[model samples]
Target: MPSETQLAYFLQQLLNAAPLSALYAMLAFGYSLSFALTKRADFTPGALFAFAGQVFVYFTAFGYDRLWLVYPAALALGVAASLAYTMLASTLTGSKVIRPLSQMSPNSVITASLAIMIVLMELVRIAANTRDLWLSPFLNQRITFWDHPGFPVVMTQIQIMNALAMAAIVFAAAYILQRSRQGRNWRAVSDDPFAAALLGIDPGRVIVFAGLTTAAFSAISGIMATAYYGSMDFGAGLMFGLKVVMIAAIGDQSSPARSAAGAALFGLAETFWGAYMPYVWRDLAMFSTLVVLAVVMRQERRV
Candidate 1:
């Protein structure tokens, strides 16, 4: 017979899984927006994100824990790093022959993004010195919720903050994309850069701005991930960034919201499968799912 402890553990997993999944969904959407606008993933987003936690730690190390400053400092760093990435990628895209040959298509833009990611990783390794990195809880606080007797769930203020931050970004991004002139221009550029350019829209600026905006959001994801969990390597962005890419790909890059859903689903699948399956074969299962999804989707895409 199943014990009460077993039942409680099951419930606990569900509760934890839901919030984590939601976080994945939000981060995935952030990356999706970047890919949607610029057709490239910001590979260095995690470094900027991890840097945010380090910034918080650095400020705290300097004895500055002003709640107001935490996000601002993080945002500033994210903007700076992501903006540089955007500019560099734009220069690369402008030089690529595929764009001119294909009349400014996604192929060259994506290639530029890949190149930019490699550069960002090397730079992060140089800048951070590859030493120990981590962040103590920003709040040093915890919360408890009880669904029933013996079914209490515990979480930290940082996790709560992550949840809130995800909510704010989602609502804000949706509103801006739906009701702004810049948003319309972004949509136009996304559909066909050549058409947008003929309309007197500088495709170069659009791509850079799009990359910049996405990088900014990616930074937010990094900071949230690091601040919530504490510390990350310069190379940590690769797995996380690729995960975002996979989520976007699974969504067929059609609907950003659906991409978010794919992210959540991916997170849940990863978490659950990792637990039930052997450690050695863990990724085999997760990635195999992605492979199958890709094959099926590609066939559908052709049709």
Candidate 2:
């Protein structure tokens, strides 16, 4: 039988990361979309993620909450940002990197992306620090327990809503991807861009939509993250975005739902090991798992 403390810890870990997993899933799907269209992995999504949330906060400050403009506002910012990135990347390297090895070398593009992320994040820091910017206390309300056995889960109002919102957004996206014409186009584009283009599909349009969808999903995901903590801190998106990239890549960027699974597993591992192992082993354990996972997935992909 599981110990009482163990049970409590497990449930808390789930509760904490389930909603958080949605954030991961959203970001991962975003990355995956871009990968699907461009046939490349990139870090531009990372910058878009951070800058999008900042846009949300900025709009909310502008008194645009009744329609909950934060969501769309963030998406628009991301669209603009990702659009600019796509345009520049295409103009500079779209034709230059058609070699087989160039297909695997996202590092050069991602390196350039790092600069965008840094500049965007620094601007956010400067703005928030120098100007009047404060998030509304969105999560002060907490769900109360009925004081029953295994029934007392103290979740914040915002956390609960954010979680529900995450679920709704993911479900909607998944459905659209599976059922809509545009989504089918995306699948065809992802399946084989060259083949799809030969079939008269516009690869550039596919890519543009893919990037737009990525930003759209990121809007929902980023704001939910903002609501989860009841505060927005500059630079937080970078850490979380990196983890999302790692997890998405680990899943080969093919399984979008794996984003959620990856997040939950990551949370569970961190909680379990942190509780049972020495602090020195924590980071090692996580990285080791990542390495092991990469190796295992490679074997599967090989076959």
* Leading candidate by TM-score: 2
lDDT of 1: 0.61
- In terms of lDDT, model 2 sits at 0.63
For every model shown, the clashing-pair count is: 2, 0
lDDT (0 to 1) per candidate: 0.61, 0.63
Tens-digit lDDT string for candidate 2 (145-246): 433354455667777777777777777877788899988888888888789889888977887667666666665565556545544566665666667667
Worst 10 residues of 2 by lDDT: 92-101
> Each model's TM-score?
0.75, 0.75
